[model samples]
Target: MTQPLAELDDVRARLDADLDEVTEPLAASALAEASDLAREYGRDWVDADRCPRLVRGLVARATARFVRNPDGYARSRSGDESVEWAEGAAGDGGVFYTEPEIRLIRSLAGRSDIHSVEVIAWGTRQTDRTGYIPVEDGKPFPYFADESEPW
Candidate 1:
């Protein structure tokens, strides 16, 4: 079922507050505009409760586009603290992520509402997390067998 448009006001308001947390002046306004864009686009594709998430994704996507150093915006937040990478022992080459993994992390990190960023290894049976995002195959965003080996 679809949600009514009036409810978007509250979501947008919350998004405005979230956008305020952004330090860059230009990025702040850009993120606000991105939220509006998400609202317009999501009215047809997403429900009310999911609108905030969609807006957050929109902000992430938009921020990924305008920023000079994309890595700077990829800090994932947990409670009051921000974590740049998920806590885990180092993988192959002692590198935490590959090029594609870095892009995915940065993309997901753009959202201000996320509490943490966790990359579940592809074959793992775990499914307790609520916001699991699947990775697409190939080139720019290749899925790795583990953090160390690209598939």
Candidate 2:
């Protein structure tokens, strides 16, 4: 029920073709599917109205790929001849954004695969403990010495 990110004209423009009745419907469905996917993946970070151009581009690219290969076949062979489909084309021939496109969306949405956190230990002094020894170095005057003592 949500609005499509791209229009039929956008898909047609990407395809560089004046879509016929049959292809038009297929393209329209593709646009809807692609738009929904973009909205779902970018719900956290993107305001659709604010970045219509990028969303539209993603929808168009995904829709075009789907319309071109609805069967989602990976390879076709005929008497020793074979045709290999493009990367996304082999997977259900469905509307899908490429890796780079997903990365762009994630970047726009302020998400990243790499993450970091500050680890803190309770009841311990907030100081750098790297290369520090309690008993041998005799630097601390808190807690039990046996905990830090070597066995």
Candidate 3:
């Protein structure tokens, strides 16, 4: 099932809150628009409870997967707290992806590019924490945090 058009407003609300936390005035509204789209289409693919978590997981997994580093340090020039947190949480053998990046994944739900296979690929990487996320592939996305990034 896909998310109803009404839920898009809620998604926008949440994204706005997140962006406000980061003081990113520009991306805040833009991401909120994307969030609206995510909330809309998410209904067609997953149930209500599953939709938000899926978005969070997809966003998390996307950051974890594509942003790998040989030294395990995701050198983000943006310096967003969310990105830094993911990096701080990772191990030397792991890669770090940002929360917003994962949020993008959440927004991708029910789209042609969004698929279980891609989500799995992102989630399967190992992390330092146990309950940071549900199991992905044979493992969970490694979640580590040295210090809380100031939002």
Name the runs in model 2 displaced over 4 angstroms: 44-48, 74-89, 115-151
Which candidate has the highest TM-score of all? 2
Model 1: pairs clashing at backbone N, Cα or C within 3 Å: none
lDDT of 3 by residue, 13-132 (tens): 444234244334333333333334445444443444555555644433323232323234444455564342233535443323355643454355534554565354654665445465
| lDDT for each residue of candidate 2 in 1-151, tens digit (9 for 90 to 100) | 6677777777877785678989988888888788777767676324446654776788788898788777775788998997776564346567788778877776766678799998767556555445555665665444455776432
Worst 10 residues of 1 by lDDT: 89-98
TM-score of 1: 0.25
What is the C-alpha lDDT profile of model 1 across 16-127, one tens digit per residue?
Answer: 3332344355455445544454444333334435444534544455543443333434455679886463234221112123344345434543533358778787657543
| Cα RMSD, model 1 | 19.8
Candidates ranked by lDDT: 2, 1, 3
The stretch of ten residues in a row with the least summed lDDT in candidate 3 is: 61-70
Each model's lDDT comes to: 0.42, 0.72, 0.40
| Strongest candidate by lDDT | 2
Which pairs clash inside model 2? Answer: none
